[model samples]
Structure formats: structure tokens, C-alpha cells
Target: MGKIASAHAYANNEVAYLAWDIDGKIEGCLGFEVVRIYLEPDGSVSLRDDGEEDRVPCAAWVGFKGQRNPHWLPQTTSIWPVQKLSWRDLTLRKRRNRAQLRPSEISVRYEIRPLGDWRPGLEPAPDPVPETVAVAKRGADGRPVLDADDRSVKIEAKAYDGKPRPLGYLGPAVATNAIRVTRWIGPFQSTFTNGVLAAQWLRNVIWEDGVKRPNELMGMISDPKNGIRKYLAGDVLPMLRELFEQAGSFLLALYELDDNELVDLLLANKNRIRLILANTGLVEGEWDVRNSHARQALIDANVDIQHRMFNNSTHIGHNKFVVHLDDDDAPVAVFTGSTNWTTTGLAGQTNNAIIIEDRNVAKAFADCWHRMLNDPLDLPTEFDDGMPDNQQGAPFRTSNETPARFTLDNGAKLEVWFSPNMPARRKSSAIPPDLREIYRLMRKAEQAILFLAFYPGQSGKDCIVGEAIEIGRTDQRLIVSGAVSSAQAMPNYVPGRKNDRNDPEDDEEAVSPHTFTEANVSIVRASRLDDRDLLSDFGGEELTAKGGIGAIIHDKVVVIDPLSDDCAVIFGSHNLGFKASYSNDENLVIVRGDKALAAAYAVHVLDVYDHYRFRAIEAELRRQGKKGWSGFLATEDTWLDPYADGAKGALMRYFARG
Candidate 1:
């Protein structure tokens, strides 16, 4: 059927035109540059060149209203104009009249065909072969034969030779073209391809290359921040806390002479056993001896206490309790050295002991303990065993016997030897004879004496300090530094003063100024001014002092002529105080050689000394009503005024006069 078309202008001078092309005649007109086009239902057509559809009317176009018959026809209609004109002429009459026509234009026409023998308003008979329909038939055999409809079939399949062109392997080229076509339809194609898509593709390729597998990749994606929170919260705090605790515990255990604290800790736990002993034949205070009431108390509580005899004639040494572990064959712990298993040693006095947790190290110490425990004849003792039948009257001949030697991991060899034996004499209960030997060695220094201690007390009460001063003033040059006194307030009368005189007459007697008399001794107060320079000029020098917490030179050591023609650093844990040297149970190892350790120790001591000196000076200045003198006192001269104006100066001058 043909359709009528129309175009009309509104009062606002607007017009619209609708076009119809029932067959596929409008396909050629579709292009990328075309702005807008709409197809109508009519068999006719209309055109608008101004690109404004609302200004034109659809009714103004011819044949747009279906002017043709509605019934089915015998043949398809063919509609075409005698001539074709440009779009410009189609809109204006003058332009259309001036346009020339050609035979080619007239030949460009449309054709449509109808079904055969079809009449309008009547049902058509069914054809034996319908267009594009497949017919199924059942024969006697009950099998269906399917045949394709003939009218709708095209010869294009046959037109192409038997060998149809294959899509084939376009490879990356085809993929690239397909991607481009897809990207043209959306604005986000560049972002997806270049960003996430590219990353995902690379990741897959990497996995294919065997660098990583898909499972590992998925695990990484699931939880990337694993263990981070726990590590920050728990592990770090506990590790650091334990480190500091161990450091403090080790230092305390090494220096404290008494085992009360350790004993208490072990006893409190109930599963462990504890024993304490002092070398036999060495006279000790009433509290330190095995028969003392204090020792009996611990024995009553099930703690073992033994005494080993070390007489001049006998070759006996104190037994050391060395703990060993079978698994690692190392020392799990070792309790040895000069510290006594007493309450004072554990709580009040300064002493040295080693607690090695390594099982291998413990085994080595155990070996040493076993060697020391054997019969006097089996081992080559350094001194005479006092047995008449023994060869040379001694366990081992000093000339033939090899000295006890130890080799450290760094390949340094240390030779141990006993000092010459002294005459047997009446023993005193206040101090042990072996300790007196140690004191004699410390006091016999001719040129220099350097002492490092953790707990130093006032002069008279501190036997080591008194002896050190006596020797320092008479023969040896002394340098003493350590943590003296407790966290409590300073004691009255500085330290070593006897309140009761042996004779009241002597106390009343006035002495001449020139006469030499014993007086109380105190540690030299270090000046605040000395702290500013850090004693750098004293580096590698012969004389120095160090004392403070965490100071590297912690071991109570005494070095004589270190790094000078003669050098030695006697170290262990014997505080240069009366209690540590005489009254309290203590231990000290005197090293007559080893210049390198001596020098390092000397330097370390000076560093600590400088620190203590600064603190002392600040304290003295503060006592003198001088606030913030630590900032002002930069030179020794500036410190002199404050020192003289305060009680510290009097004490220092009094000691100097003595």
C-alpha cells in the first residue's frame, strides 16, 4: 500500500517532515556524520535539510498518510520520480525548476514485488514449499525427513567456493581491532585498558612465566598485613623489657657477694635446691663462718652449707657450684668466684660471681670443678699439701709443674699462678687470710693503683678503702671510683669514723699540728667543671677514674701501672670498703699482667669518673646554695670557689691534709 506524506508550519514558524522507506532503501543514507533521522510507517518519503524536525509538519509530505489500498496486491509497487534533484532544489521551487535531469538519475529507481497470485481481502492458499520453512514428513518406517523451504533460500552459500575463507589466526592484530571497536562505544575504555586491565594482564602473564602461582597470588590478596599488629604490640614490648631486666639482673648477680637474694628466689620456687659454702680454714666473721648462727638458720631450712679447708700445708680451694645441662653440654648456670653464700653478700656487700646459662659453658666450668675436687695426689697442686710423704713436700713441684693456663676464644692466653706463701700466723675472725693475701697484693703497688667498684663505703668501715688509702698515701698511687652508698641519704660523718676511742686518755690528749695521725678518709670529690671537657685530654693517660650506673667499667678492678712500662688490672668484685674487704664475704681476682684489658679498663673508668665527678660537683654546688652551677662551672678555677665555700671543700681539705 502507498502512504500519504505531509509537512506543516506552526504559528511559531516551525515545520516537521517524516520519511518512510518500507523496504531497506534508507540503508545507504545512514552514516557517522548524520545527526538525526526517523523512519515513519508510510510507503512514501519526506526530507528535511535544515536539521530542525520540529519546524516542519509530517502531514505536509505526500503519500505519508497511507493513500494506497490496505488490501494485499498481486505485485509489489514500484515508485520513482522521472528525475532526481539535489537536496537544495527539493526545498525551493526556483532551485528545483533550474535543476537539469539526466538518464542516470531517472534510472536510479526503487522496485518492490508482491507474492504470486495473491489477492486483496482473501486468504491465500498454502504453498507446497513455504519461504524459509522446513517441512517434516513421517514415512512407513516412522523416520522423519526434514526439507528446507525453497523460496527463502539464497545462492550465496554456493557462490562462495567449497573452501570458505577461515577467520583464521588473526593473532594480536584481530584482538587489537576488536578492542578498538569495543573501546569506541564507551568513554572509560582508555582507563580500564591502561589501568586495572593492564595490571591484571601483567599479573597473569607473570604467573604463566612461573615466577609465582595463582594460589600464592590469592593468599597475598587475602591478607597483606599479616602479623604486623601483633608484632608491634606484643613482641616488641616483651623483648625490650626482658633485655633491660636481664642486663640489670646480670650486673647485680655478678657483683653482689651474698646469695640470700638468689637463695630466696630459688627457695620461693620450691622445685630448686640451693647450697652455700665458704673456703675452709679461712677465719671469717661470726656471721660468715659455717658454724655461725646465720649459716645454721639456712641449714635448718634445708639449704646445704659446706666449708672447704685451705691451709698453708694443704692444697685445697673453694668448691664452685657449676650447673650443667645434658642437652647442650653447656653451662646452664655457674655460681662461682669470691662471693660468699651469706645474707650480707647477697644483700649488702660487693662481690663477684658468674652465672652462665649456656650449657656448654657450664660443662666447662663443671670440668674445672671436678678437677679441683679430686684427691690431692691426683692433681698437681701449686702449694705444699703438708703431707710428709709427698715428694718435695708439696702436691706438685713449682719448677716442673705447668701453670694453670686458659685460652680465650680470641686466641689470648692467660696464665694463673699463686703468689708466694706467707708464714702461718694467728688468724683473725674479722677477715680471711686469703682475702688478706689479696689485700696485700693490692696494697703493694709501688707506682699506681686503679680501683673500680660497684659498692664503695666510707674509709674506716671499708677495709679495702682504708688499706687502699694507706698504701696510696705511703707507696702506691691510687685512683678509686665506684657507686658508693645506697640510694638513701648520705651517711653521717662521711664513712670511716670511730665514734668510740680505744682510750679515753688518748682522745683527750691534744696532738701537735706537725705530728702525723690517722684521720677519717673519704673519696675525693670530683669537680663539676671537669665534666665539660669529658677528660678527653686524659685519654691514653696513666691516671683516670670512672664511676656511675651502666658504666662500661663495672667490674671491681685494680690496675697497677696499666699501659705504662708495667701494667695490670686486678678485677672481680671486691669493693674497696671495710665490709667488702674484711667483714663481708667477698672475692677478687688479681691479674698481674694483661696490659690491653688494663688500658681499656682504665679508659672506661675515667669515663665513669668524669660522670660521678659531675654529679658530685653539682651536689656540692647545690649544697652551697648555688643553683644551676652545673651550667656555669666550665673550668677548674670556677669550681674552686664553690668547693671552698661549701662543706665539701672542708672534707676534701681535711683528707688532703691527712
Candidate 2:
């Protein structure tokens, strides 16, 4: 069957054309330059490139410069948005007495010449398969441990070909081309070669668990135009609802709830949605979770909340996320982070949230979410125990299995790590997949590492994940700064000199631990983060304030060597802590290959580091030669009343003490 194709999509939009040469990416003709086919007033069409008139091949495409198809695959370069053919309408407005391109442009009916007698639609330029290959190996949770260069280099059977030839577009994985792209990925190519296509984005949507308690839900709701409603309800909530309507099915994994408005919104779309909501009884106000208005609203919407309940009936279902599946019943989108669905959480507290649009990543999250529905009875605490028999909830999912690597738009990669933290329940059973991946990634750092965890009591140099980064630091490195807790357990602190692991005679390691405050890593307590005292090296940017959300950097982020080839960042509610590792249901999304992203976060890290490095100097003076993790302000009340604030801080400091 011959397919008649036309470059018609997105009714009433300008059209651009790309003519793919017979050369593959190996020969470096990978990027096809888009050209506009202009219709002269004489009814003669002329090509923008070299004036090719009647005979030209083109594919219809729509989207902004940096955007792409939802799947964003190689096939996406040829995805047809409108089946038959879409129209393009253009109207030029009055220019501000400036430069103009098309003189008072009007809509033009763009025409594309058919290639040969049959047009089999717009066929994407073929990709040449590689001679040798190494893709991500998956673990139980579908995440692979990327190598030091932020990718798992898999060397398969190598075959010698005469030279690079156009093997006729079979999905470019050919030898040297593979090596080149794999080594240093470029835009568009990464999204296709990697499994699921995702346009990588970092949206720092945060709620301040700051100094001033933001106005109540009612107060903010009253002024929908400019208050919390504008940012939270109007903005954030609608995106989720839109996702639900478009998705095939839904999974709700929340730690706490009570945001009546959000619940009501979900209820409004309940019939159109197929949802499985799992809560940890946090909304019941039993443990650390705040109260929410989920139950009644769910009941009103006839939403079934029974079967998937993960209340501490056994394990604390301390996970937070919502997974959406497309009509094909596969995962489409995922939402996760440190937020509990509550009026206060969205409108008041310092929190984080993320929305990822990737079938591969979404599928992984969906798999993890549905596995929780099985609700195993209990997890085996003993390292000696085989797989826990009950399989009650999302158990530790790991192995030396395979890792799934997803490349989104603009040469960016997203590697997801979710958990029951289940991995080796026998030998290295001590570290589950979630924590272990963190350990593996941190261990791969060659140059630098930056961290900013809202809560650090559960993490330290001695902790497994913490030790991975500390123990594996390159022979010489900067004085690490950020969370005060990670600063514990240092070898020795010589004010001006950096650590020298390669020097055979630098055995200052044998010095008495007492005099050296011993911590090579400088500690800066966010609780005491103050701009009045510290000057930022990045700019006079006021990151640290006397009081505000800035007072507490509540984001769990890890930026590894922002300027390196292996640049990457991992963050989410998945705090690199002991508690978050073994018990809490958390998430970590690692983004690689995007320099702009790494640099953006690099500024944040460097800013925090600069601010804290300055603060550490002041803190040491205040410490009066104290030799341990310094005490910091505690999160005593609001969300944690009756929970002795002193005990929590004291215990954390004690655990983190050198």
C-alpha cells in the first residue's frame, strides 16, 4: 500500500522543511537545517535553500524550537499531528518601527512535492545501528547505575566495517557514530537513542515551610486572582487534573492529605479517572503526616480508597507521588517530591514537587506504585532472611539487574530511582536499591559533590550513602560544605591546605583526633543561615536571610561536577539519609548531559557553598574549638508537636558527632 503524504500539520501555522541527505549521522549530516518554502506573488514556489523549485521533499512539523513530540523519538521527527492535513494561518502585526522579515505576511498554503510515485507518509531519516553497543542494564526498579561519565558504557561484540556508509537509515547506532554520540551526546540524538524521549526540565516548585505561616487556605482562596489560588490551585492543581484526564489510569501515593480544594478537584474528575489511591494514614493525623480532606471528598466522588490502603497497618507507606497512564494503559506522566497534600503544605511550608512527562519514567513509577497495591504483610529486617514472604508493600527493588536510561529533548538524560529499597536481601542486604544507587552514583564522583537536604539528622559521613561520597573523594578535593550533618567525621582540618591522599608522607592522619575538629568538610547549618553575616561569591544575591524559606534550603539535591563531561544532578524527596533509604517511600531523578541544567544548579550549589563556607568560618569561631557536629535549630512544632524538638536535635547531633 502506497501512503500519500503531505507536510500538513497544526492548522494555520508557518511551515518549515528539512531534506535529509543520503548520509547517516556517522558522516555528520545528522541535523537537517529547516528551510521555509516561500510562495512568490507570481504563484511560483522557491526553496529557501539554493532555490530548488518544483521537486523537494519535506516533513510537516509543529512546536517551538526546543520542543518535540511527546515520545520524542527518531520517529518523532516525522510524527503527524493532524491526520489528514492541518492549515497554517498568519497575520503580521504592526512592527515597533523595527526590523521585519516577511512584508505584512499572510497565510500561505505550503506545498510539498511527493518523492517518487508513492508517498509513504513522512518517513524519518533512518538511524544506522551501531557495530558495538552498551545500553543501561536494569535493576528490579528499572534503574541502572550509570558510570562515572553518567552513562553505563556497554561494549558489545565489535565488528570491523570497511568505512562508514549510508546503510540506508536503520536507526543510527553504527560504530564510530555510536562512540561519538555516546561519549559526548548532542541534542535530538540523545532523546532518540535513549529509550523514552523526555524533554528534560527542572521546575523548582517549592512551598515555604518558612518563618511566617502563610495565610490559611480560606484567606488565600478568597483572593483567587493573586494569592495561593493563582500559584497553587490555579497553576499546580490544574496541571495534575489535565494529566488525569489525558492519562489512561492513575496511581495516587500520598503520605498526607487535607487540601480540600485539591481533593475536590480530583473528585470532579473522578468518573473520567481510573484511580488507585494509597495513603499512609498520615491524613488520619497519627504520625508525622499532617491532616487533609481526602476521605470525605473521595467518598463523595465514590473513589475506592480501601484495596490500595498502605496505612501503617504494617509498614509506613511514607511515599508521595501520582502516576498517570495513557490510553494504551502504559505510564505517561509522573508527579513526585517532598510534598504532602495539605493546605499548609502547598500554601505554607517549604517543600518541593516535580512533574515528569516520560512514558519510560512514568511506567517505572507506575510499576512501583502498583506493586504497593499488593500490600505485603511485612518486610524482613534480618539480612539473612530470603525475600520477605508476605511481600506486603513496595519491597526493596534492586539487583545487578539492568538500568533504564532515558534521554529527553536538548541532549538531556533522566535516570529514575524509586524504592522499597529492596535489593540483595542476603549479602549486601544492608543497602537496598534506592540507597545503593545513591551510594553508587556518589562513589563515581571524580571532582566535586554538592548537597542540600532539608532534613539531615538521618545522614552523616558514617552512614552508608554518606560514606560512599566521603570515602571515594578524589585524591584532592574542596572542603565540602552544605548540610552540617555531612560535615562530621573528617580526617583533619588544616585551615588553608586541602587533603592530599597521594602524598606518601602526609600521615597527619595519625594525629590525635581531639585537637583537629577533625572534620575536613566544613559544616554550615541552614538553621543559622544568615545573609547579614555571609557574603555570596556568586553575587550579592540574598540566598540566606535572617528568616524565610531561604533560612532553610529544604531541597534534597546532589550536583556532581557541574562543569565535567559526566555532569549530573539527583534530587527529590529521596533524602540521602538512613531513614529515607530503608523505610520511607521516596524518589530520586538523576538528570545527565544537560550542561545548562548542571550549571544552573552549579550556581545554586556554589552559592550555598560560598554562603556556608563563610558561615562555617564564623561557626568554628563560635564553636570555640568544639570537635563535633554542631547543634542546629530544630523543627519542633507545627507539623511536629508533642514530638520533643530537643530530643530530635540532640539525637541527630549525637548520631552525627565525630
Runs in model 1 lying further than 4 Å from the true structure: 1-448, 454-462, 475-483, 486-555, 564-566, 576-586, 621-658
Candidate 2's residue-wise lDDT over 1-658, tens digit each?
2111112211101111111112111121122221223445554554556656632222332322223222111111122121111111111111111212222233223332111111244333333222453333433432344466655434333222122222122122111000010111232111000000000100001111111233333354334343333333212444455555674667777666666766766677676454444443332334223332465567676874533333443334556677777667777777775555655445333344556767777877777665555543432242122222332332344421234568785667787765446542222336555556666756676555566655534324324334533644543343334443232322232223335768756645422121122233433443232223322211112222212322134456676755566777766666665555545556677887666455434444444433344345554554465442222111111212211222212211111111
Per residue, candidate 1 scores C-alpha lDDT tens digits across 1-658 of 2111111110000011111111112111110000112222342222457644312110101110112111101111111111110011111111111112111101011111111122454333222121222222323432233235322221211111112111111011100000010111110100000001111122222232223443442233223142211111111122222323331111111111223333444344322332333333323321223323434444567653333223322222323233423333333543343333333232112233333233333444444333323322222142212222221112222221233444434333333222112222222335534446546666555445554454454333334544666665664224333333332112222323344588555443321110111232234232222323221211111011111211122235555655343455554334444333322223333444544444434443433333344455445545555563322112112222333233232222211211
Question: What TM-score does each of the candidates earn?
Answer: 0.31, 0.47
Q: In candidate 2, where is summed lDDT lowest over 10 consecutive residues?
A: 190-199
Best by TM-score: 2
lDDT of 1: 0.28
How many steric clashes does model 1 contain?
50
Candidate 1 lDDT score at position 106: 10
lDDT of 2: 0.40
- The deviation in Å at residue 146 for candidate 2 is 61
